[model samples]
Target chain A: MKSIKEINQKIREGNICVVTASEMKDLVSELGVEKAAKEVDVVTTGTFGAMCSSGVFMNFGHSDPPIRMQRVWLNDVEAYTGIAAVDAYLGVTQLSEKSEEYGGAHVIEELVRGKEVTLRAISKGTDCYPRKEIVTEISLEDINQAEMVNPRNAYQRYKAATNSSNQILRTYMGTLLPNFGNVSFAGCGEISPLNNDPDYRTIGVGTRIFLCGAKGYVIGEGSQHCPPYGTLMVKGNLKEMKPEFMRAAVFPGYGVTMYVGIGIPIPVLDAEMAKATAIRDEEIWTEIIDFGVARRERPVIKRVNYAELKSGKVEINGEEVRVSPLSSIYMAEKIMKELKRQIEAGEFFLSAPVERISKDCVLKPMRLKEVKLVRSVMTPAITVEPETSVEEASKIMIQKGINHIPVVKEGRLVGIITSWDVAKAVAMKKVGRVAEVMTRKVITTMPDEPVEIAARKMEKHDISALPVVDAKRRVVGMVTSEDLSKLLAR
Target chain B: MMLQLKFDPKTVKKPIISLATLEASALLNIIRASVGPREGELVVEVEEGKAEKVVEVLKSYGVEVHSIKKAVERDEEKCVHCGACISICPVEAIGFDDEKRVVVNTTKCIHCGSCVNVCPMKALALP
Candidate 1:
């Protein structure tokens, strides 16, 4: 039995394998079908057909698609610390609802989670669409153990197999890229192995490439007709593949994939690898098209010639014209110059109306400032002296459109009478004077008191307005609901 | 299940261990323990007339007041000579003149340190 390390080493030395199908010209060109198929030991001629026929076959479902994974090593402590620093910079903290402020729960959670735990960061790709990158770190021991299980077993096997290959890619990329960010473990998919030689028994194992990052616009090209997992590669120049210049590469998949490296042992390797994959995925086998600069179109100008005028009629360039019913001939001449200017400035077109304003005229708009409150603005109250006859008081209420009255004696607020009091007196047929029906107990408020307090007191007592009084208990200014409303409106 | 066993006692560590083994949970527990409980307090200072209104508003919002102290005031005329106000006023609201007359600043006096009682000249009064 060969050790896992020996199997991986042998697989790395084997010949590259490729596959091609006659119907899939696009896929074949992308994978280098002829050359890859000839070098591999196991060449399945009908593999593509088998994949097409088995619409829902379990493992076969993903067999035909190219697979990639992002592998990260977590040996360095600085990588862990860097993740913590980023999280702090992002202001990820717990907020309290009661105090409406940041609290300790967030800090506690961070300390417990070892900071290097998988975190999702939103980033903009070459396509300008937001992509989520999973930043995390995993132990080598965990990777090795992952190989022994059924599903979990595959991760470890791939980790061990691709370690050396990734190291070579990482080193080569280091000298090639600038400001290479960190690399972390990302997702993996199945791809046709480069070499299927018997010596390459671990082809499936070592074939899994670590995804560093991606470049160009990745669009979902195949998603409309079928479930998309395949990518369409657009060919472009190497210079075009740079992070700044690259356009979006359409991936027929549902959404874009962003792989983030966290707690990675080789931070430079991770970032560089991601960049290379992005460029490769962007180019590979794309159709060529001319994308040239587009020119701005100039505005077209139309000429209108006005001729001699006669009363309401005007002649233009030997043609006599009656003034338009909607506009005067004199106005039309003024509008013509404006219309011409508007067209030259590209401000108005044939579909828009051209309007002319007098040069000397200026618009003065009005705005409201404050609302003033006064006694006349209120629902008025009847006024009378205590000596007045009941007949006179009732007549005063009818004439003044008031329901309540304050009875003054010797220039003092003595009592108040309302329409209800008069109605009660009339109903009882008490043929008497004003003092008999008047309620002597009256509520009054000072002018300096806040209007709100006066309003509250009136509401509590079920009255309309408070008769404002001076230190001598004489009526001065009257405050009512209308006054309060005016103050509030202001 | 097969109960058959082989006698190869190489003591090989299990390759696949649960994630619980890496102190992830232990570390989380430690963090939770370290957080303890929050101790939050807020202090607000208000003028005499507005203090009652502020207290009423705070009480409506369910805040409790631990204590209330009257702010200081000074008698402009009575404070004179001796420099007793300057020595006894804790907030330094009082100062002695070059002519040996004592001066009292009504604003800085907190009312808590009553220098008026200690004045030998009986020149200081607080309201």
Candidate 2:
């Protein structure tokens, strides 16, 4: 059994022995585990997924007149500035204060690419530190230390999830296609780091890893790391396990996301460690679960190996379902290759864990007590009488930022006038009143009707607005796409 | 003188396998064809006015044609220009227009769906 020192000696002598987990697996099969272990020096593992728990700690070196940052934002994503005068932690999934589409994850990616990011911070002025705020742009080079430490990442085994329900699910699993049209699995099953080192053997606190584009380490047992198999011995090949092996998690209003981490350990030990490294895609398994059920006991639709999932199609519940890898396998392979290159060039080396990851940590379910906040306000609809000129109706729409105005007569609804109808009239050069351009068949909703029903009616009729009407058919409020979105956001 | 065709392997095995041979025999000219795990993405060339016949033959063999275009097409109505598609694109096909709308450069796009898969809006699709 060759030790890690020997591996280093070989590297020093330019006889670096390293192989990817996949290659190591092949070697073990060809030369037997013991022999393969003797020859190989390191086995690299990798995973690239939406790790929500990922974040970076940065020490933005003191500004001219140092201000203890009370509030910090990196590209508009709030970062924790409570640590010190210049240090802050930015979570990957934190939505941008300016735009929901941009998040802390995007910021991390940009930093890795050496792109400049706008840094803005606000602080109460102190006698020692005079500046109250600072706005600047910084790149990775500008920060004293920009380190990524994900609380959890490359999961050992992840479940394939789909919505069996009719409603489309917007989840961290990506969008769950309606009616199980598509299934999303978030782990690089075979090639993943934790999947290969199933028992945590050499991977734990202090183990060095390639984090995002930087070097990071395992700090401790990640939050909610209750692996299906016990710490003693990871049982049967992943393929044969029942659906009970899978875990279903929900982040409440945020939708569901799996717990995972990407901490690839550099095995510095003997051949047994080498054998542990040689796990392949065919050996790892994950569950295909119907995530439609609200209970923790999600139904297992199938038990398939990662190989079958990697094939892009898998038969589950007697139907062939299209499988999409939420994790980027391409990025994972790129990481493995880069790690191999670093090792071969003696640019990077292995380090032992300071602590072993705890096996007993269980994920506690998130239970939010039911609290209701009633919104009693509804903006009254601005009505355009049927006799109003089309030009006048168009002016009203433009001013109100609204696309549709109810064409009412006296105290009752007559029709609806839309921006499209106005534009069509203008294009046709028809000089007429609202009645000439308005759609006579208007879909109206009662004031008590749920905003969802009104939204659906608008969608069904391909209209932009549904006028909220009273018992006498007089317009009271208007539910538009914007209103429905506000309701759904709650 | 090139065309890209998509086919499903689960349905049309014979027609897909015969494509390479058909190219050699001058039945069709091929640039590349990838019959991957999900579907077939082929770049081929057919004589003028004979493209319809080729599609017909492939369809008869049970291949579902996804798109028959010179390059990838992006539904402008669906795109939110969120920039999610920008990072994963192997080729710099999809980019922001001056108005900040994501526009696909049909010339550069290989229809890899690298952008399509990661698009949160589901705006990008294979062609």
Candidate 3:
């Protein structure tokens, strides 16, 4: 078995052999894994796709007077200023306050393209740094530090997406057509960095990589990183990145995301490593998730191999649905080829990890104790007895300038009276007590329920209002479609 | 000779393309489309002699039609030949050449803007 040290020595002497992961497959098949492992020094792997959890950290270098900025913005897109005085982290998907398309990803792309961007900041003046506001233009050359630190990149097993609902779904996975019209998926598959070393055998903290046209390194395990399978936290030099490899993209309905090209070299330490790099698209399977569920845990329709997906079609629900890849295999091949060239020329070398990723990465949902319930959006209920006359109910409706009134008996909702029922009663010439015109079997909601649940209930019943009640069924408040619509509009 | 047709959400269900073909007597060549239940966009080419007639027929049914000069401006220098736009075009207007560089068949392209939107490098843009 060859060690990374011996490979580096060979690389230094200009006698090392390197091949792309795709070519490695052919090499391993021709010359058995054991012999190929001895002949090849490194197998380069690459992937290019939209990575949303990506951002850049920049130190704009203190202003003339040195401002301790409380809020910072680049090209009208706000950057996270929770770090130091002048340092900020700009997330890729952070949208501009003024427009949907312009975002921090655009800012990163502009900086990489060597264009200048306006920088604005506002702060509560302190005695040591008495600057309230500052506005200036800055470029990559002007910033002292421009480092890309993506929390998650190069997913080992990416999921393909399709829609099962009747309406079109505009998601981060791209626009999904209604009724399983098309399938959209990402990942360069077999050549992908994490896919080549799924167990992180040779890849871990401090492993050198080709990160978006620059030499970069893996820092640690990223969020949602299912062990043995992979997702990596990577960092790279933003100034060295090329626009072709690291560009900003705005999916029509979704916000902006960055497309990153990442390549990793797998040193042929043994037959196992050689076999790992020889994995093919037909052998790798990804889940096809139905994105129409509108939930965190979407339903997985089937496990389909990348071979079928790349062939432009896959069977879904017993029908041939056209397949489209969001990831660019063309760019991935270029990255793999360029990396192979670099390794052969002895310009790049493989480095072992400083630390192995932790195996105990259990993803947990954020326990939001302050979650907004229906009570927060509901209006306090006004109630009347069933014995109340229709004329009095109509008078109360006009006085309150409201549409519906809930009728209660012994602190429990029995019926609901609307202005329409009053009009119908008048038209039918049957003016009587509230019970005669009121609608029983009211579709009620609970105060403790989430606002979305109430909204869905109203939509299902095709009604405008709902009575919010407690365990005793007493109407505590009222919620209407108007409140939900206003909240959505805001 | 290429024509782009846009159907709003209400008009998408109409059998406009077949009707236009029968009435105009033009065997339209579909180059690209991105139609959904909400709305639809189509790019088609008609014969030189019957191009004006097809446009007139489509317009009679309230279809927004445009005779395309060029679907988009392709910046060859910036394009990385990524296949992100390959199958995204309803019509196979964008395809890889022998060397795998994205070749835009301007004559057959419908200017649906799908490729232009998905190109991360910004190599494709509206003309």
Candidate 4:
């Protein structure tokens, strides 16, 4: 069994201890106040009185305002030359002693002391005028003047303003100090309320409170703010705080700190540091998500049939088998069993046509190795000859269900005619014969040439087919798109 | 048209004197010590009208000047026929004659302690 101290230590180390104010209370109750105090270094009271009485000073006005003169002093002529150089070099002179005096030496002394003084100085052995002005205007009056009715109201306003300012400051700081290793903030009212502390006054709501890079008084309450009795110290790693605060502080122009107060009994500094670390870890996780580094879920497996497979063979999807009689028989049996299972499951529908799987999987497709054009193919060519009369050629073309024919003279290649040629001539109402309209310069290819080459030549010339001829220039066969389609289908 | 010559890291030569080895004063001393006086010789020269301006600029940048003069020459046969002055010529101006005698051309010489450092013959002297 663990000792009470060990158990308390374990609780403090766990992630749950850092979440909220109530959880911290529960932890303190379970572990006892002394152990809890040891676990959490900083505590926040929800009351404005506790926060203000605790001597936690916040500056809300602009920083580094223009310098101004408070008073002036003068010195003897001999002292002026000697002390002026030293005062000028040091950028300050003692003038409080001579503030009541109004004279040239006194003014010069004031100028040397960095007081707003108009005076003359010797330059290159000649006196020259030197003008200086001091602007002094930084005080509590610069703070927003909204009145608070009660401590709770003051605390709420302070928190709201601070949170809003922090949102902006976080963004700016993120860009300006990207490498700030860790960040933490500690105070009361924002995190908790004052309990039984009469000397402390409540912080007014919306009263400007400044902390680190975050500015503003207060905003809405968060779960982290509870059981207002102690100062709350927020801690987090820089990595975590960067994005959380950077978004508001840098890009969108808001002031906000990205730290969450860890309300454990550990040292305030340690708790703040731990918070920073936790924030950094959270930021790393966020980065991972943003970069799409998460693991994907598995896809559902679906059953497929032999006819649906793109390989032109039926086999188990991932199983490899040799092309042998026994293996083929075994595959057939397996397929039968798979089909039976589908049928028993009532998934196999006879009325619905099964779709073929994608053709992308096919390794190779069958094509025509050799084409033998017999009398049937030759007759189509003969009907569209150019020498034949247009009427005769049209009659033959209509009867043969062919559109083009080779025009041969003395059994030698000459020209070709087409139904389109006769139709065009008729449309123009020309009296010319078929020979006049037939194309004389014929495009031809060899029978041995590849089908693809013939197709490319036809496409290049924008013609339908190329007449395939032998070495003796005798027309042997003709290759067309329809023939190529039939070949590809196989 | 303005032309800029950039000195990339790849091309700069090693300095004759390492900055780590000597202070600025010592370096200037070494440069000044390199020149020595010679009879009828002008050891250093500044362009006709630019001497004062050049000195001012150098001074502004903390450079020191030593003696200034014109050139001088030594006859090959004028010496005691000893080669003592050869090593004393700081700028490597002294050489040996065919008979192994010393010869000095003051124009190329900066009168430092080159021959003065180890002049066994003591045949040469500075004005």
- Largest DockQ belongs to which candidate? 3
Give candidate 3's whole-model lDDT: 0.86
Best by lDDT: 3
Per-model TM-score on C-alpha atoms = 0.20, 0.60, 0.76, 0.19
lDDT-based ranking: 3, 2, 4, 1
CAPRI quality level assigned to candidate 3 from its DockQ score: acceptable
Better of 1 and 2 by lDDT: 2
TM-score, candidate 4, chain B alone: 0.41
lDDT of 2 by residue, B1-127 (tens): 3556667657535555375435333366564677766677676666656666666666666665544455655666444343445534555565556533456777666656655655653556665
DockQ list for all candidates? 0.01, 0.04, 0.29, 0.01
Which prediction has more favorable DockQ, 3 or 4?
Answer: 3
Clashing pairs in 2: A152-A261, A153-A260, A153-A261, A153-A262, A154-A261, A154-A262
Better of 1 and 3 by lDDT: 3
lDDT of 1 by residue, A1-490 (tens): 2233332333354421211211123433454544322232221111000000000000101111221111111211111112211222111111223332222222212222333323223233223322323344432121211110011111100100011111111210011011111111101111111111112222222122111111111111111111111211111111111111111111111111111110000000122211221221112221111111011111211122111111223222343322211011121122223322322343321111022111122324454463232333443334689888878888888987666778889889898878888899899997478889899988877645555557766886788777777678877766776677776787
Worst 10 residues of 4 chain A by lDDT: A285-294
- Return the clash pairs for model 3, or none: B31-B91, B32-B91
Best by TM-score: 3
